[model samples]
Target chain A: MAWVTPVTNRNATARMTYLDMNRISGNISYLYNYAKDHGYDVQGDDVSQTTWTQNDIISYDFWYSMTGVLGEVREAAGLDKSVNYPATNYYSVNSLERYTLYTWMEITEPPEYGLLQNREGIQLQTESGADIEAGIL
Target chain B: MPTISEANKMQIRQPMDIMVTLQVGGDVSLTYSGYSDAKVADGRLDEPNKKMMPLTDLQGDGYPLNGSCKLYRPGYHPTSEEKWGERSNIGEPCSITITASESIGYVSAWVSGCESVTFSGNDYPVVNGTANIYVEDTTATFTFNPLYEDRRIEVSLLASGAYFIFNNDQIISCVVSLRSDLSLINPTLPESEIELQIYQDEDISERLASIPDETLITYSAGYSDEMSPIRNFYLSEKITWADNVMTIHAVDAVHKLDIQLPTASLLTDGSSDTGEATEESLLVFIRACLLYAGISIGIMPDYEDGASNSSLVFNRISLREAIAKATAWGRFGDYPTTWINYVDAGIPKLESDYSSAGWHIYEEDCGDVKRDAARKIKEIRMPVSALSFGDGGNYLTTNVGTGTWIYGSGAFLDFDDDVFAWSVITEQNAGIASVKSDETDYAGACERNALNFLAIKGLMEEGLPMGSMNTFYTQVMPWNSLQLATWNRYIGSSVREDQNLIIIGSKVLKDTHIQSFSTGEDDGEIITLDEAPIEGKLIVQHLNESAQTLYPNIAAQSILNMSNVTGSFKWKGDPRMQPRDSAYLHRVNGVTELITIENITITHEGGGTSAEITYRKGKC
Candidate 1:
């Protein structure tokens, strides 16, 4: 009889993902100032810095945030979840959650492309007629 | 009857006397000093006609509003970046703004309430409606910042932005957006709408911005070194006394005007080395030399290839026949007797060439001498090889040593003991190898020949201005130094400053050197040129007017050395960067004073007898 005992590697237990708030905040701040100086304002909006439940669980991970006003919470934290499944012979819970933890977090918005470069349909289609189908999506 | 010389002098003096009389008021009389006595004609004053002085660009208080227009296509930019637009001093209390609204394209602006505005060329455009104004004014009042829906405004300015226009003339207008006030209500729906905004400055535009427009009112001498004005180069000092040699040098104030002439075909190289020259080129050169002197000469015939041969025999034609003859003969070349024609027919013959070159000289319908004085008369010089400088091994050669140098001599070749028999190819390209190869010895030979020729002529001497240094030494340095005949033939002189200096265009290295010589009492004094301070380098010197000097900033030497004009060099070395050497030409601010190149060309060996060098046997 082979003595079989399972043990998880303690060294790989969990690593803290460092969030670069300085750069992100700085870029956001620049964009915000640029817009403000140019006489355009979305003053009520917030540049949030949210902490997701998968903060220490996922590799190369930092929570990404979208901006929204306080009343429009759905637009800000729209269905963020981590679906973690079993890797091998081990029952582990990849914690998934969307906790509006930093809903009031302040963020500096990075600059965006100017009025001329931002339109969508302005880009050209690669090929109107492909060999596969007419409206191939 | 007055002799021809006296008649010409009287003709010149006649107009002068009348003009003086009119200047002194209606009482104008000619005081004729007769052959043996001073005879005063009393009460016979020719009444002043008060002839109108011809109108020119310089006649008005302000250059008459040649024209004016607002500038279009304005944009915003960073504070440090340079913007393209006319820079003018704020003459009075005027507001100039580049306004950009959602409805209109950018337009240039000039808003002066009570002042004269002058615009340069059609390049300055002014459109109404839309503009993205980047104001450079501390005093501008944004009273009512025009605002509309879907519109954005961006403004930037350098510190203390003040326009410098002559008092009273307000300059306005820059980069106006295209028309946006058409049909669209909001005007923001259009996809390809042109909007003006600040962007990063590219390096090339930055360089283009720094070079100030150096306004050098130069008159071209025949076959001018076209490379001069286009490159911010100028010929400031030149001394000329001889006919055969002109030591040409030019300086690019920013870089050395060290242009090396290709040993190959310079004509096709976009370098204007026309094989044949006429009075057109002669006049150009003469005008260049005499431009500052104010002496003028009329056009002469292009005698090379015997263009004057036809017009020489046209004396028999009557005045009516002369006009008819002029219509029939487009160029003096078509006439066989041009050389023998009287001086009175000189104007007609020139008119003929002008017409053949697609210019209407005499309006047949109006029968008027369309004296468009705007097309001023100028002189030019043609290189000897361009005309007729013999063939092959029997070609002219200069033996520059302390010994007797025999040139233009048939005895040197030993063919038939009287004349040398060799087919000489005067065209520069004939001597160059067409295909590139290790055996392309011709190019090497040309370079060596150029160095020797420049050395012999004392052209590469020190203390010359920075402008001429690069043009001659670098731009057109030849490949063969032994081809003395080709080098000599290609080198020709014209008057850049009438009677005072000779403008020699060296094709081997498209350099224009004004030969400096002095006449009368101030001839021998060593005039130091340490007066006009340029960059930090001081071109200290002492030399006679007959000598030449080449002065280059130590920073510009690398560029010159790269061009291979290793003439005399002196460097003061840079203190900030130790152990690192710098070329002279790059020293933009270090140039100190009106420095000159000093060199004396002693053509005589021992007997001290001056020899007359001619282009062809009888042409000069």
Candidate 2:
């Protein structure tokens, strides 16, 4: 219904791309703020995600928990040893209902538009058989 | 299982009269050793059901073993004093006590018996725990601790016979505390100053002189099968005996007879100057006056039967003819009874008038002079001084002395300034004399009047001078739903409002109905209670039924439990329809099981029929 609006008139269209798995949860404000910094369009796919982003950003706090801890890197980086990030069980899959969107990239793809890295090593292709490029305006 | 004490095995002789307590503290298997006498024939005690069985036949566990029963032996006589006392002399004794209490400055107790004695103390007499040995009776004093200490008073009496005399029948002199400072300032009016005046057309002395002392006229009448059993018993068989009893009654039943004469009498001439003062006009005036009197002071004069459908028929005749005819009949009427006389007598052939038919005319002849007398009887009440006169203020025209005025009956043409006139009634005064002779006439009138005043105004004891308070004790029974509801609210609201002061004459039994008094703190005393009359119960039952009928959908079980229900039905319409008497019994006491109407009475008053219904709560 509604997409994120760009803060500057210099940006013709606003784009909201999820750089990683957490991008979908960070909400339109983070995308808008990022867009404002990079001078890009702040566009979001879902209106609910764009219209009221405060509720969504407050709920997406899982990223803050993991950033402070890494098992062996803490010793190498001189980080506090007592700091712990709760491990996520990736094997436990959530059942998909009607509203769930399953978007992932294929192998040999540089990256999807919004993801940081493709752990599954999937490649991205357009429906018109155009190869997904790593750097796009 | 444990054993019980021998003292605990007492029998409940009379259940309803007394409260019993059963205390079993220890762990126990309780059983009732059914009662038996302890006499045996041969070394064996003959006890009935000595082997302990289950307390009751019904199967139950941890059930209540202590309860009260209403079914009791009525003939249980408590200990009496005549049997307890050898001889007693009650003398006049005065005791005074100075009280620190704010309202009460000093209190004096006057104990009267035979001789006089005086005693003094502070606050109260120092007699508690003291023994006083008189010539005949021995009396002991005990300090009574009532629920409310304010009402506490030390009581002294011959305790042994007190129970017996109190329970069965005996009168105790209730000594009242008098304020010696309270003195009468004004002398009361003498008893003679209070006079009961009866204004009538004729002095009854002359008429009574020709009569026999005891005359019995009996008639048999059939009653409907639907009549109440009690009323049917009264009217059918008991009326004859009741009549005899009424004849013997002194004051209420024609005992004192005084004869006097008004200064003037009604005169009938051949012709009258004014056309309005004709026989018809005179009769109308008399009837009008009678109607006014009847309505103002609740009296119904029996004159004629109404339409066949009518219940109450009043005396309705034009003024001139009524007076003229009454005067004529009184003058020339014979003692002999006739059929036409009976028809004109208005003896109340119907049931409604049967009770009050005594006032109707029984027998009289209308000879030749009737027409002449009728013409002249109309000119009398012209308000002109010469036309009429009456006795002086100090003297009243009583039922004593004759010859001053041609009263009782007789046609007249004289104009006297001072005479008080009444239409002369004789055996010949048709429609009046016979109805007035019924035995129930006067009592029924009193009952009707009393009921009207009470129901309309909450006060009782009417028809008396205000100063005559001693004649009747004023007992104010609350009679409205609102009042009753409020009173009950007060009672349950707090322990403060639960206080009650029951003052009967001098014996004041206070501190009753208080909640905390149940814990044996109240003064142990007995009050001789008088049973309430039945008429009050009838009124209460009527209200209960009316409330039910008026609000069929409302919950009546709780409403009926209310203490007082108030509304008006006195002198508002037909006197009979109004509720005058209240029945204390109708106030709910025991638990109500159901509402059922019973003993309905339908009668006529003031030209209308009235219906009364009473209900009882229980399985009939």
Candidate 3:
């Protein structure tokens, strides 16, 4: 199972939490830019968000919507917005399927080195609840 | 589109008696609709003194809708009272202002019985026979001088020698326009439009009925020996027989690809093509598409899609849109159709332009660079939208998002589902690609990567971008894709340090799975379009080609963002000078510019050929 379950945290109050979500927000600078480029009049109040944003898609709907939008980008066949082109296994492409496997081992209580809101440093906790300051870049 | 040798060019340029053999399916007859009906028998419709032949229109624009199309040779000199053909050029003619109440169409003094001789104009001294009149709603006096540059001036009549001969039937005249402005990034060259007027003795309409749609019209131009490379094929679309002339209109092979193909069974997702051992390629897919389209293969690119037995993917769209979306890249050149010659003489068997088959990417990344002495001759892929191949689009970070809260267009476990629980495609919100280890349901969504792009962006062509002040016209190339040309067979990449994808115009529009499409009209049922706004299904059905769907799939509306082609020129005519042909255009200053042919307009009449070439400077 993925570390952050979408159903469980679709509307998380915190911003820029997950590494991949923030990274994908940075990976794609096209969402709002493409909307402007294609004359796709923005339907919501937030039309100004046109650059790199780690401000979260926030729900399964927006994430899948972005995926569907990717299908709109011209390419070979992999941009599957529908099942018509499904081998039914292409979703495992890259690390997508890998994340779906191996349950995320969560600890019931915070450990001695758990992260805190007041200060910012680095907290590395392994599956066995140990802490380390590896400083991994 | 073939490359003619310098010698062939010189031979074509040399003034010679170009033998013209033009024939339709059978005999045809055409009657000129001008002048007095009284003089129809003799073919002379002018006054005894000014016997000028009526002017014919070459292009289809500004065809006199009022049926009063009257034009006499302005060749007749009024000041010197010189006869027609005496002057080498057409100088301005004299005209006078007329009242708004006067009838429009020109009344020629040359015609057998036409005359509105109220008062003579300044130029004509002999007698008032020609009147270029203009009328308006109010009593405004209008000076009606013919705009020499209008569509009317572009036409020229085919002399008796240039007429098409087919037994008892005869072709009066024919005009053809090939390719278009270079900026237009269609997958392949567009269809050449042809219009012919035939004079018939009997009702050959019965025989002509068999050659309307689907029949390939094999048209060969230039000398008999050199005509092999100049032949073009067209599918007959419409034929109209009226006033003894058979008018036929046809298009190129792109039209033949409209039929639906079993894409699900042919083009799989290619899961095995992922990982290190796998990548992207368009070869097999292209062949498969052509087979389903029933189009014959003439030229195939060099790239190959990875292991053919990859996991199947699911996607449904129109065949035309599929071909337009899929692109390939390679080093390609045009040649004669001799490899796939006509079954019999003057008949082509679906050899629609072969160059279109290799319309995969050609010199995509190498942007607008002037002549690179190092790379002597390179290909010019149609300039697509900048967002296409390179420049990573909305890809999931790390190909799999860091599991978190998520929101997408489709429904899932909740309006706000956990990122790990995020999934969609139609109803279930489950199958992303497939179910994997520890996952209760499938969840691969959009981790997609684009190696190429659909060159469906519209092009705004300007003869001289530096000179034209008006807004350039945006023309959609309509057919090409990411198959931009490259020395290597990989899609251009700017984000990824390692270049991995390879495509050669695959069986892009294939069906790897053999599932039948439901024909039920449940897509929509519009009882009436009277008051209701247009529904999605109605729009899709009426659009016919599904071109309205995501298939025109161009990510951005790229208009004149990048332009390699600059200007154009005119030459007597070269059958070998097709659209997209790489050739040299010699300027008056003795400097020869290597140019890519963008648009070609050819007129063959009176055993003579003339071509108007729209070209761009050849570059990276």
Q: Each candidate: what lDDT?
A: 0.20, 0.19, 0.30
Among all candidates shown, the one with the greatest lDDT: 3
lDDT of 1 by residue, B148-262 (tens): 2211111111111111111001111011111111111111111110111111122223222332332121111001111101111222233121222222122222111122112
Interface RMSD in angstroms for candidate 3: 31.7
- Worst ten in a row by lDDT for model 2 chain A: A91-100
Q: Which 10 successive residues of model 2 chain B have the least lDDT summed?
A: B175-184
Number of the candidate with higher TM-score, 1 or 3: 3
lDDT of 3 by residue, B283-317 (tens): 34445655676665555533224443332121233
Better of 1 and 2 by TM-score: 1
Q: Score every model by TM-score.
A: 0.17, 0.13, 0.33
Off by over 4 Å in 3: A1-137, B1-169, B184-189, B209-212, B229-236, B259-261, B264-280, B299-314, B327-563
Question: Model 3 Cα displacement at B226 (Å)?
Answer: 3.1
Would candidate 2 be rated incorrect, acceptable, medium or high by CAPRI criteria? incorrect
Q: Sort by lDDT, best first: what order?
A: 3, 1, 2
For model 3, report DockQ.
0.00
List the candidate 2 regions with Cα displacement exceeding 4 Å: A1-137, B1-250, B267-298, B301-352, B356-620
